[model samples]
Target: MNKLPPEALEHVANYFRTLSEPTRLRVLNVLGTSELSVGEIAQLVDSSVANVSRHLAQMAQHGLVARESRGNSVYYRVADPTVNELCDLVCGSVARRFDQVVSAHAAFVASTAPARRRRAG
Candidate 1:
């Protein structure tokens, strides 16, 4: 892949920074493909309405989410579909890493088991 310009790299960094917050990630997961009001998102994430609203505002500003008003309430949905793909990629990588660690630990324990038995006897 070609190297990105400094300004482009900065924008990329900013976008990642926007998704860095755990609450925002939870908000995105709860949102999925559904457009939900602040209260709905708050309920799903088990957070206060005010807190959810603030996070939504920040996400909206970053173009990570879009807002629409329907009668009395504003509903939000993911504006960048690629964000889901990005999250999935990271999650898969993490899961694979965890599996490797577990497998390695099991192998280590198995390898040492016979040595321990030999020493005991």
Candidate 2:
């Protein structure tokens, strides 16, 4: 099999590293829907303003998101629509896995539940 060039591998690794944090993933998820200010993002993600700002800055540095300053607030958006696509891919996979688990659990519960007799009204 052909291996990725070292530089390409490094770039891919860096991108994955940026998304390795749950907070960063949450930030990306929020930004995927609409642009939001740091304060709004922090509140939505249950993170501190300082921490959100730091994460946004790191994401911007990696070209994962773009920021625009309006008045005193900085609003961030996904740098590329492809990033949103990647987010969707990850989220879809997770949702499918969760659905499978829930279905399996439901089947097990149904089998284990006591049968009930029908009563005439």
TM-score of each: 0.90, 0.77
Model 2 Cα lDDT, one tens digit per residue, 1-117: 169899998888899899888999999888775999999999999999999999999889999999999998899998978887887898899999999999999998787665432
Clashing pairs in 2: none
What lDDT does candidate 1 reach at residue 66? 99
Model 1 over residues 1-121: C-alpha lDDT tens digits?
A: 1699988888888888989999999999999988899999999999999999999998898899999999999999999999999999999999999999999999999999999999999
Deviation from truth (RMSD, Å), model 1: 1.7
Candidate with top TM-score is 1
| Per-model CA lDDT versus the true structure | 0.94, 0.89
**Cα deviation in Å at residue 1, candidate 2?**
11
Query: lDDT at 91 for candidate 2?
Result: 87
> Cα RMSDs of all predictions?
1.7, 4.5
